[model samples]
Each structure stands twice: as structure tokens, then as C-alpha cells.
Target: MQGLIISALIAIGVIVLLGMTIRIVPQRNVYVVERLGKYRTSLEAGMHILMPFIDKVAYKHSLKEIVRDVPRQSCITKDNIEVSIDGVMYLQVIDPKSASYGVDDYVMAAQQLAQTTLRSVIGKIDLDKTFEERSEINMEVVQAVDEAAQPWGVKVLRYEVADINLPASIKDAMEKQVRAERERRAVVAESEGDRQAAINRSEGDRQAAINRSEGEKQEMINISEGEKMKQINEAEGRARQIELIAQATATGLREVATAVKEDGGEEAVSLRIAEQYVSAFEKLAKESTTLLLPSNLSDVGGTVAGLQKVLKTIDRTQP
Candidate 1:
């Protein structure tokens, strides 16, 4: 009976020891087990058994993705401008054994490396580009840190730059510059509009002036043509009057010549010639001009006597 009880107690002790040695880790979790202070194999999730006294679980890390934020750090840019930068890193443990033994603190190491990498990257770019090229800088940082951390069994999944802080004075200067640029553009646009309007107005005025001038010129031309036509008509009328008077005078001269030629004696022709001479002398006397008589009083007296006889005959034939 004593031996059976001792054996039963030993069995119970062995079962308890076995129970303590078996570990059931959850999914996505890894246990870095060590044997006698030396690194053993990493224990994966679900039903991992180890030597209770010889082997110990050193560190447990989740295989799931973890996020850590890099604190804001002051950095100088390529333009010698100072700025503050912050970022976040997504990481996962690829190898729990190496993550346990490779570095003292993988989280601290990754954060420091991220900060330094961020500073170095920011230093190569201007302050304006630091914010604009944040994605590119994130890619560069992830690549660099991922490469460096490969031996440590850490995988960097993604990196993101959260914010970039500029100095208040720099922000103020940028705002002023933007405002000035807008004002300059507005003024230029306004001036261009005004100039175009003025040009249009001037063009309209020029056309109007041209039209007015053309109208005035045409009016003056019409008036000048009318005056010319009036003067031509007056001159034509005077010419016609002179032509009619000349025709009448020519007819009267023909009648006088016919009458003189039809006279039957030289005495009648002499009388007619004396009457024409007397009429011309009477017209000359009206103008008060002196005439010298010929030195033949007998011939003049004979002409007067012939004219008197022709007058007496013409009076007897009158109806």
C-alpha cells in the first residue's frame, strides 16, 4: 500500500510537470524559447511543448502588423531651413528567434533608425519639397530601414509621414507671397481688361470720325457741284441771249441790204448810206465824242438832199 501511494504521487508530479511544460500559444503569436541561456528554436502558435527546466520562453512577439509612431524631430533642410517631422511605421516580426537575439530592443532601434533616416532625407530636400515629397521620403525610409532590419528578422511593411511643421515666420512669409501674387495677377487682369476696353472704344471713335468726315466731304462735294452747275447754267443762258441778238442783227442787216440793192437809182443807195452814217453819228454824239467832218460841204449837202427826197417817197408809200 505505501509503494502504490508513492508511485501515485510521483505520477501526479510528472503529470503536473508535463502540463506546465506544454504551452498553447494563440494564433499570430510566436514565443522565442531559450535552452540553458542559449537560443533554441522559436515556438509557433498551437501546442508547443518544451523542457520545463532546460528551456524557457524568453520573449513573445506577435506576428501581426504593429504600428509605431516616430516622434517629431527637428531637422534642417537643404535650403538651411528648419522643420519638424513625424512619421508612422508598420512592422511585423518575420523571425521571432532573430528578433529576440539580433537587437537589444527592436522597437527602439526601428524608431531611432526611422528618426535618423527622416532627418537625413529631410536634409536633402527644401522645406517646401519636404512636405510635397513626403510619400517619396516615406518610401525611401521604408526601403532603407527594411534593408537594415532584415538581419534582425524584422520586416517593415509601410511608412507614412504624418506632418511637417514649418516656422511661423516662414508660413507668414509664404502667405504674404501668395497674397502678393494674387494681387499682382488681379491688377494685371484688370489693367488688361481696361486697356482692351479703351482700345475698343478708340477703334469705335476712329470709325465714327471717319464716317463723319466722309459724310461731310460728300456734302461739300455735292454743294460744290451744285454751285458749278448753277454757274454753268447762267453762262449758257447769257450765251444763248447773245446768239439770239446776233441772229436778229444779222436779219436786220440782210433786210437793209436787200432794200438797198432793189433801189433803181444810185441816188437811192446814196441816200440809204447817208441815213446809216447819220444814225452812227447820232450814237457817237450820245457818247459825247468829237468827229472831224470831211472837207466837202457840197457832197454832204447833196447826200442830205438825196436822203430828204427818199424820205418823202417812203412817206407817200406808207399805209
Candidate 2:
């Protein structure tokens, strides 16, 4: 019975010793070891053995990336506006020993540093810029926090500003300003459209007037041309009629001269002349109030004889 109890105690002791000496670290995790209360070395992934009761794992750190939320804080901008800001930070531990000993708590330290850096960056710019320059502010915060966390074995990969809250009154005022600007632009655009329409109408009227004037000018030219042609035709017709009358008169006169050259033509002409003289005197007596007498009024034969003598002389002179 005593030997069995002793064996049982020894087995228990061996189990406890093995459990304390051997460690199985998971992937992406590291263990910080301390021997005799002093940091010995860091254990990587896989199995590790330590001197039992002397070497102990002091700290466990994960090498994977970490995300931390930054608490909201009030920041005053260059324009003296108070705004609330919050963000998230990405970080990773590169050195286990430094991460364990360099700072009390790296995650907390990084969060506080990020807040301070964000405020500093915000205070350098206007409130309006705070909303527009979020990326720039985030970049600045990451740079500053990463630099300060270098000794703590924390690498700040990036910082993102999650939210920026503004006053309700300011939002309302901005809305009003934007609405008024849009309305003014609309009015200007409408006026521009009207102006262009008026210009188009005027241009149309001008073109129409030009076309009408051209048509009128063409019509007048056509009318004048037609009138000119008509006048030319009438003149030509009258000239032809006058030429025919003159030719007929010439032919009649030639026939009369030929008859005068024929035998007994002189006697016929003298009798005709006497008859025309008497007819002329009778017409003169009726048309006048007073009777007009020829030089040989009492002797009509003497007048006839003088006319015959003048005719004979004209016939002798003709070729």
C-alpha cells in the first residue's frame, strides 16, 4: 500500500512538470519568456521547452494585424469651431519584447496619441477644411502615431476618420446658402435662354425681310422688263404702219406722175385743178364771216391758166 501511494505521487509530479515545461504556441502568436525574473527571449510559433519553475512565459502577443476604435473627442478648429471627431486605427506588433516592456499598454497609448494628433491637425485648419481634408488628417494622424509608437513595437498602418459632427445650426445655414446659389444660377440660366430666343427671333425677322425685299425687287424688275418689251413692240408696230402708209403714198404719187406724162394727161390735170380751185373758194366763203376774193376772182379762167403754166414748167424740168 505505501509503494502504490508513492508511485501515484511521483506520476502526479511528472505530469505537472511536463505541463509547465512544454508550451505549444499557436500560429501568428509569440510568447515572451522570463528566466529568474529577467527577460530571456521570445518564443515563436510551434513547441518550446523551458526550464521548469525557472523559465516562465511573461507575455503573449499576436503578430496579426489589429483594429482599434478611437473614442470621440472634442476638437477646436482654426476657425474656433468646436467639432466632435472619432476614427479607427490599424496596428500590428512587430517586436514581442518591446511590445511587452516598452509601454504599459500599446493599444491604449496609440489610441490616446491618435486623439492628440487629430486635434493638433484640426486646430491648424478651418472647420470647413476638416470635412474636406479627412484623408489628409487621417494620414497625418497615422504618421504621428506610428513615429511615436516605434519604440513600443507597434506599427500604425493607417488611420481612418469615421465621423465628424457639426452643429445643426451650421448645417441649416449651409443648406440655405446652397439653395440660394442654385436659385440664382437658375434665374441667370433662364435669362440667358430668353436672350438667345430673342436673338433668334430677330434673326428670323431679318431674314424674312431680306427675302421679301428680294422678291419685291425681282417683281419690279420683271414688270419693268415686261413694260419695256411692250413699249418696244408697240413702237415697232407703229413704225411699220407709218412705213406702209409712206410707201403707199409714194406709189400713188408715182402713178400720178406717170399718168401726167401720158398723152392728154395735161388737159386732164388742168381741168382737175380748175375744179379744185372752185371747190376751195366755195369752202372759204362758207367758213369765213367775210368773203375773201382771189386776185382774179371775177375771171376764174385766168387762175386756171396760171396753174396750168406752173404744171407745164414742173413737167419739163423732170428727167
Candidate 3:
């Protein structure tokens, strides 16, 4: 009976010991084992054997990516503008042993570090840069957190600044600045167009003035040329008239000399000369209103005697 009791007790003790030594770790999970209050080894997924009273499972962590939202925290920008920023971070445990011993609480440490680093980085940049460059801020936060968490066996894969909060006054000011800039550009463009138009109009006016002046100059030149031609014609007509008068005077003198040299009797010549003079006077009277009178009536006898001598000479020369 005692042997039966001892066997039953041994079986119960074996079962309890087996329970203490054996551990079932689920997939995507890690267990940090500690022996005698010190880190011994890390156990992965599947069955693991742990020495009773010698080795203990200290911490269990999931290897899968974990995401948490960082709460909004006030930060001061480089330009001394106060802002509130919030973001999310993705992290995973790499070494379970280090994760258990390297840090007290990885999640709390990461959250606080992320907030501090976010403020520090944002404080180094202006408000405009902070508002415009969210991705850069996110990357800076991720890098800082990853570097700090490296010793804790935690890998910070990525982080993102989801939203930023700004003062109403700043938002209004930015909007006004944009509107003013657009208006200024519009005014400049309009002024430039006006200036160009004025230049074109001035050029056109100058060209028109030049054309009018040229036309006036051409007209004056034509008038001067016409006057010159008219003057030339007048001079040529006066020269022709002088030449005709000289020719007629020479012919008249030659006829008078021929008549005198001929041996026509003076009385006969005087009668002929009188008749020729009357004919010329009658011709002049028909063409003009002015009358020509003899300068001396007593000289008429001398003129008749001279003509008779001229006729006699002409008659003698006929032989």
C-alpha cells in the first residue's frame, strides 16, 4: 500500500515538474529566459524546455510590427512659434533578451523619446519649414528614435507626423500673404503691358510723324523743281526773242544798202521809199493803236532827193 502511494506521488510530482520545465511559445512570439535573476537565452516559437528553479521566462514580446499613435505635444519652432504635433510610429522587437534587460519599458521609452526628439527637431527649423516639410520631420524623428532604441533591441521601422496644429492668426496671415503676392504679380503684369503698349504707340506716332515730314519734304522739292523749270523756260523765250530782233534788223539794213547802191534816181527812190514806209506804217496801225509820226516834215524833201539818186544808180547797174 505504501509503494502504491509513493508511485502516485511520484507521478504527480513528475507531471508538475514537466509542467514547470515545458513552455509552448506561439508563432511570432519570443520569450526572454533568465537563470538565477540574469538573462540566460531567448526562446523562439515552438516548444521549449526550461530547467525548473534554474531558468525562468522573464518577458514575452511579439515580433510583429506594432503601431501606436503619439499624442499631440506642444513644440516650439526655430522661429519661436509654438505648435502642436502628433504622429504614429511603427516598431518591432528584434532581440527579446536585450529587450527584456536593456530597457525597463520599451513602449513608454519610445513614446517619450519620440515626443522629445520631435520637439527638438522642430525647434531647429522655422515655422514655414515645419509646416511645409512634414516628411523630413517624420524621417528625422524616425532616425532619432531608431538610433536611441537600438540598444533596447527594438527596431523603429518608420514614423509619420499625421497632423500639425497652428494658431488661427498664423493661418490667416499666411492666406493674406499669398493673396497679396498674387495681387502684386497681377499689378506688375498689367503695368508691364501698359508700358509696352505706350512704347508701341509712341513708336507708331514717331513713324507717322516721320512719314508726314517726308511727304511734305517731297512736295516742297517738286514745287521747287517746277519753279526752276518755269524760270528756265522764261529765260529761253527771252533769248529767242533777242535773236529774232537782231536777224530782222540785219535784213532791213542790207535792203536799205542795196537800194542806195543801185543807180535809181533819188526822186524815184524817194517815192518808192515813201510807199514802203506807208505800207509798214499801215501794217503797224492795223496791229497796234499807237501811231508813229515823222520827226521832221522838212526832211521829207531831202529823203525824196536821196531816193531819186538811189533809183538812177540801180538803172545804170542793170546794164
Candidate 4:
């Protein structure tokens, strides 16, 4: 029984020794080691050995990326608007020794730095820009934090703004402003439409008036042309009638002259003349006019003398 008890004790001591001397680090993990309470080396993936109690794991760090939530904080914008801002950050431990010894807590340092940087960036812009320029705010925070966190063995990959909470009064005022702007645009558009419609109607009326005037002008021109044609036709008819009358008178005169040239033409013409003189006197006396008798009315020689005087008067009157 004493020999069995000593063997069990030796086995227990060996297991404890093994546990103190060996370390199995998982993949993408780093184990910081300290010798006599001083940083010695970093143990990586797989198995490692330590020098008994002289070396011990101080800090454990992951090589993979880490996500940390940035605490919500109140920030004032350039416009003096207070807003609540919160975000998230992506980071990774690049150097285990620096991460362990460089800072008390890399995650806290990075998060605090991110918050302060966000506040500074937000203060530089207005509240309206805070909502619109989220990406810029995030980038500024990431760049500033990453630069500051380099000493802590942390690589800040990305920063994202999660939410921006505006005050209720500001939201309501913005809604009212947007609605008024829309209403103003609608009124302006309606007025423009009415003005265009009025312009179109005026143009239509002007065109119609022009068309009517042109029609009237054309009608007047047509009437003038018709009147000119009618006047020309009537004048031509009157000219033709005058020419016919002159021709008829010339033909009658020619017939009379031919009859005068026949046998006994001179004595018949003298006797016909005497009869025309007697007939013209008789018609004149019938109108209650005075008539004077010739002293040689019974003599043929005196009558011939008087007929010769009448022929001279007729010849003087002809063209």
C-alpha cells in the first residue's frame, strides 16, 4: 500500500509539471508570455513549452478581426443642435506584445478615441450635414483613431455610424419647411401653366384674326376684279354699238348718194328739197310759233334762189 501511494503521487506530480510546461494555442490566437513578471515572448498556434513557474501566459489576443460597439454619446453640431450619435468599429490585434504592454486596454482606448474624434468631426459641421455626411464622419473617426491606436498594436479597419437621432422639434420644423417648398413649387408650376395657356389662346386668336382679314382682303380683290371685268365688258359693248350706228349711218348716206346719181336725180332732188322745206314750215307753225311768208312765193325762180341758200347753210353745218 505504501509503494502504490508513492507511485500515484509521482504520477500526479508529473501531470502538474506537464500542465505548467506546455501550452496549446489555438489557430489565429496569440498567448503573451512573461518571465519573472516581464514580457518574454508571444506563443502562437500549436504547442509550446515554458520554463516551469518562471514563464506564464499574461495576456491572450486573437489575430482575427474584432467588432466593438461605440457607446452612445451626446454631441453638439456647429449649428448648436444636440444630437445622439453611436457607431461600431472593426479592429484587430497586430502585435500581441504591444497590445499587452503598450496600453491597459486597447479596445477601450480605441473606442474612447473613436467617440472623441466623432464628436470633434460632428462639431465642425451642421446638424443637417450630420445626417447627410455619415460616411465622412465615419471615415474621419476611423482615420484619427487608427493613427492614435498604432501604439496600442491595434489596427482600426472601419468605423460606421449606426444612427443619428435628431430632436423632435427639429424634425417637425424640417417637415414643415419641406412641405412649404413643395407647395411653392406647385403654385409656381400652376401659374406657369396658366401663363402658357393664356399665351397659346392669344396666339390662336391673333392667327384667327389674321386669317379672317386675309379672307376679307381676298374677297375685296375678287370683287374689284369682277367689277373691272364688268366695266370692261359694258364699255366694249357701248363701243360696238357706237361703231354699228356709225356704220349704219354711213351705209344709208351711201345709198342716198347712189340714188342721187341716177336719171332725173338733180330735178328730183330740187323738188324733194322744196317739199322738205314746206313740210318743216308746216310742223313749226303747228307749235304756235310765228311764220313769215316770202314775197315771191308764187315765182319758181325765187323759190330756186331760196333752195340754193338752204343748200349753202346745210353744207356749212356738215363736218
Top lDDT model? 2
Evaluate all candidate structures by whole-model CA lDDT and list the values in order.
0.86, 0.92, 0.87, 0.90
The runs of at least 3 residues in candidate 3 whose Cα sits more than 4 Å from the true structure, single-residue gaps closed, are 1-17, 185-319
**Backbone clashes per model, in order?**
0, 0, 20, 0
Instruction: Give the per-residue lDDT digits (tens) of candidate 4, residues 147-253.
Output: 99999999999999998888899889999999999999999999999999999999999999999999999999999999999999999999999999999987775
Every candidate's CA RMSD: 10.4, 6.2, 9.0, 7.5
Per residue, candidate 3 scores C-alpha lDDT tens digits across 1-319 of 9999999999999999998899999999998888999888888889999999899888999999999889999999988888889999999999887788899999889999999999999999999998689889999999999999999999999889988888899888889999999999999999999999999999999999999999999999999999999999999988988998998976775666566666763445577778886688779889988877778645766766666676556556653
Clashes of 3: 20
TM-score, cand. 4: 0.62
Estimate, for each residue in 1-319, the C-alpha lDDT of model 1 and write its tens digit. Answer: 9999999999999998987699888999998888999988887879988898898888999999999999999999999999888889999999888888899989889999999988899889987788678789999999999999998899999999998888999999989999999999999999999999999999999999999999999999999999999999999999999999999987775565556546564467676677787787778778876766567634766767766567557545544
Give lDDT for model 2: 0.92
- What TM-score would you give candidate 1 relative to the actual structure? 0.57
Better of 3 and 4 by lDDT: 4
What ranking emerges by lDDT with the best candidate at the front? 2, 4, 3, 1
TM-score per prediction, in order, is 0.57, 0.66, 0.54, 0.62
- Predicted structure with the largest TM-score when compared to the true one: 2
Per-residue alpha-carbon lDDT of model 2 for 1-319, expressed as tens digits?
9999999999999999999999999999999999999999999999999999999999999999999999999999998888898999999999999999999999999999999999999999998798798889999999999999999998999999999987888778778998999999999999999999999999999999999999999999999999999999999999999999999987785676677789998778778888898899889988999996757687877877887777667666656
Residue 6 in candidate 2, Cα distance off native in Å: 4.4
